[model samples]
Target: MLLERGVTDAELQAEANRIAVKVESIFSSYLAGSGDGRDRLFEAMRHAGLGGGKRLRPLLTVATGRLFGIAEDRVIRAGAAIEAIHVYSLIHDDLPCMDDDDLRRGKPTVHRAFDESTAVLAGDCFHDLAFEIIADTATHEDPFVRAELVLEMARASGPNGMAGGQMLDLVAEGQVLDMGSITRLQQLKTGALIEFAVEAACIMGRLPPEARTPYRGFARDIGLAFQIADDLLDHAGDEAVAGKRLRKDAHAGKATFVSLLGEDRARQQCSILIGQAIEHLEHHGEEADLLRAVARYVEERDR
Candidate 1:
């Protein structure tokens, strides 16, 4: 299917990798100018921000923005904001009080690489920096679009979105949750940012909700598929390639799509979700080829 549109999976991967590099550079440059009295916090921020990850959210933002003919620089700036917020969440999530993770992106987590206090400050700084980037007029000439982007990002990452979901996850620890409950949990925990990634493109383009509604649906399906893939990877994926601890959910006795649906069923559900996600893009032209490949790649990716 990807080949028919002249968009190969490799090409899509290459595009995402390119975006990752761009975002890393943006972050590195942003932290490089830190003055005295806070160099360690900035260093921790650079470590967490520039360290390798899939940068999937930024890719989604950039790809969707490109579809609307937004300028590459503007979209890349927005992508950087998305990645900053994401890395910030990762830093906090790895804190001793949180997930207590020691490894991330094949290196020691921010807290492990630096002191816990510095890691906390790094996460806080990145969180603040995300909005600063989006709010800057340089991200968009129009003030309204920049404001909308900031507001959307706030909702996506604030109590109603990722943070709220994390709170719920903390409370639900070691407790059995039903499918509906778990779905809602994962939607908020992981899906909110993914939704923001796609919807931010609409804001970047100054497009109305009616125009970007399909992409929202696309984000919804892909978000769940992405979580399911994560669960599957955690269930059986190699920790070396995954670059973190695997089977933590199972060990913690947390219910996941893989645990609840079984590996085969969870895999089948991912296929179904990807199909639906692709369906939402039918109204788009070949320009949306990258999104289609992204959907397929999420299903097939090993890390």
Candidate 2:
């Protein structure tokens, strides 16, 4: 269903790589201040933030923006901002007090790379930097529109959204949860950000209201589907194959779709969600191609 936009998975990945490198360079430039603490901070930040992710959020932003005729450079700037925010979340999530995870994206977690203090500050800094990037890039032409992007991302990233979801997940660990609660937590924790990524693109691209809503919904469902696959991978995946340790969530007593639904059923749910996500694209006609491919890949990606 995807790739109707004349781009292959390999091509998408290539574009993602170029954008990723550019994003890092921009991030590095932003961090160029003279001080030992700054150096330590960047070391921890780069340790966890640089390289590894498929940069799917930013890629979605770029691709969706193109659908609305937004300039590619502007979309890339928006993507870079969100990707940085994402990296910030990961840094904090892996802290000793949070997930307590020692590794991520096939390498040592930020705290392990540097120290807990540095990691904590680095994460905090990155989140703020996200808004700066967005605001800086979006300030001209339509200031309100550009500012709206920051507001949407802040809401998604803040305590009422992703952060709140993380706190809920922490509290819910080892406690039995109904399907609704499980789904709600995952939706907020992960789906909100994915929604932001899509919405950010739409907003950046200046897509019409009606079109953006459905696409953001598509992104939300895809995010949930992607999380389900992640939960399953943790149970059935190899560390090397998955690029992160397996069975960590289980070991930590983290409640997940896999634990609640079992392997087969979790996989089934993912398939169903992917179907729903693709169905949202039907109105796009040809524009839906990239989205459909991305939805499928979310379900099937190994890492």
**TM agreement with the true structure for every prediction:** 0.97, 0.92
* Residue 118 displacement (Å), model 1: 0.7
- What TM-score does model 2 achieve against the real structure? 0.92
In terms of lDDT, model 2 sits at 0.81
How many clashes would you count in candidate 2? 0
Per-residue C-alpha lDDT of model 2 across residues 183-253, encoded as one tens digit per residue: 99988898888888889877766776786777877888899998999898898887887777689888878
Clashes of each: 0, 0
lDDT of each: 0.88, 0.81
Residue-level lDDT tens digits of model 1 in 1-303: 333544787798789888888888778767885578788888888889885899999888888887898876789888889889999999999999999999998999998999899999999999998988888765545888888888899999999999999999999998999889999999999999999999988887888888888989999999999999999999989999989988999889999999899999999999999999988887778888887888888898888
